[model samples]
Target: DTAVSQTPKYLVTQMGNDKSIKCEQNLGHDTMYWYKQDSKKFLKIMFSYNNKELIINETVPNRFSPKSPDKAHLNLHINSLELGDSAVYFCASSQDADSPLHFGNGTRLTVT
Candidate 1:
């Protein structure tokens, strides 16, 4: 079974549209995160939640928001999407800050 999973593996939308990506982890991990991979393949952490509490919020735009209703789930919502928003969003989880991460396949977002 997959340790981490994300919905809508591929998403295509027009600029200014609002979109969301849902993620869940079954690894019984305490920390979950959202990372974005840019066109250059550089990955950056967007947000991190530990036990349903927000722990890390990176320097991303205000238009991008992460919501965690529970410890096992982390969802990302983007408003007023722009062409620059086209990238792969990955959901990951780890037992702790020093543990290895288990990542989902990723959700590719395309804005035209």
Candidate 2:
């Protein structure tokens, strides 16, 4: 089984449209995270969930939301997408907060 999986490896939408990406992990990890990689390839953590409790990163915009229905799943929702939101979104899971992370292949989002 895949350690981490994300759906819709590619997404293209209008600038003002909203979309969501789904993620799931079977590694039995306790912590899950959502990461965004900008065009410059700078990766930043947007949100973290431990045992289904949310912890948002201060730098993330209010338009981004992370929802964890359970410890093994973390989903990302973007509202009113912008051209600047065009990038790859990654879903990752770690055994613990301090352990190395296992990332999904990533979803490429394009807002035209």
**Alpha-carbon TM-score of each model against the true structure:** 0.98, 0.96
List candidate 2 stretches off by more than 4 Å. Answer: none
lDDT (Cα atoms) of all candidates against the true structure: 0.96, 0.92
lDDT of 2 at 1: 91
The TM-score of predicted model 2 comes to 0.96
lDDT per residue for candidate 2 within 1-112, as digits (tens), equals 9899999899999998989999999999999999989999999988888899886565888999888888889999999999999999999999987899999999999999
Error of 1 at 38 (Å): 0.8
Cα-based lDDT at residue 100, candidate 2: 99
Reference-based lDDT, residue 6, model 1: 99
Provide the lowest-lDDT 10-residue window in model 2: 53-62
Q: Judged by TM-score, which candidate is best? A: 1
Which clashing pairs does model 2 show?
A: none
The C-alpha local distance difference test score for the whole of candidate 1 amounts to 0.96
